[model samples]
Target: MDDKKLVKTLFMVMTHRNEQVGLSLWNDNPQGYNQYCQWQTIIANPRAMGLGKRYIESDLNRSFNIPNPRTYEEKRA
Candidate 1:
């Protein structure tokens, strides 16, 4: 018999690439950053952030429901 506790992973998705709040939060707290290493954090639109825009083709926040996924944001979804 195996008895072990499972820790559920936290998924922090940066839907809006233009927002730097999360980055600031992580940078401000070293302890939080250490804990964050165990969680899944995804920068949904890296290209959008690089280009200084909210998104490239479409908004990633709404792209998750896309069926065909034609645009870059849709593909990212």
Candidate 2:
């Protein structure tokens, strides 16, 4: 019921299933989380929705701070 206990329980469950509740390098989970945040905020602009925005490189982390980068804060600004 408490946040700690809930997190522990979730962690155990995820660990048992070889799943992670956090970002995964193979799945661009960071970008996914960023986009999800953008959707929930007023900063949910076209750029936030994966529009006009270009990822010159396919690296999400690299794209994380490219001036008009695509990270959670950028999207949720």
Candidate 3:
């Protein structure tokens, strides 16, 4: 997520795989920023597709903001 230009970001939080979006803070940052959790969470997420930097190149890697919740698009499948 840091490597590519962030098309968007949610300072609060996002969804957890197999669960629901905005269910909870995936993991508080060192400064308590409830972002997309740690780097591991990004890789571990089923939604992440394990693409890493390549994930950024794909359309799914585009920023997904949970603020809008269920209606927004994210390649959850």
lDDT of 3 by residue, 17-66 (tens): 33334333345331222234333223223333333222322333343654
Candidate 1 lDDT over 8-68, as tens digits, reads 3444445576677676544444232232243445566778878888889988878887878
TM-score of each: 0.65, 0.18, 0.18
Candidate 1, pairs of clashing residues: none
| Tens-digit lDDT track of model 2 for 1-77 | 34333321111111111223331432342222232231111122323224434222242333334567455434333
Assess the local accuracy of residue 73 in candidate 3 as a C-alpha lDDT between 0 and 100.
Answer: 30
Which has the higher lDDT value, candidate number 1 or candidate number 2?
1
Tell me how candidate 1 scores on lDDT. 0.64
Candidate 1 lands at a TM-score of 0.65
Error of 3 at 9 (Å): 8.8
lDDT of 2: 0.29
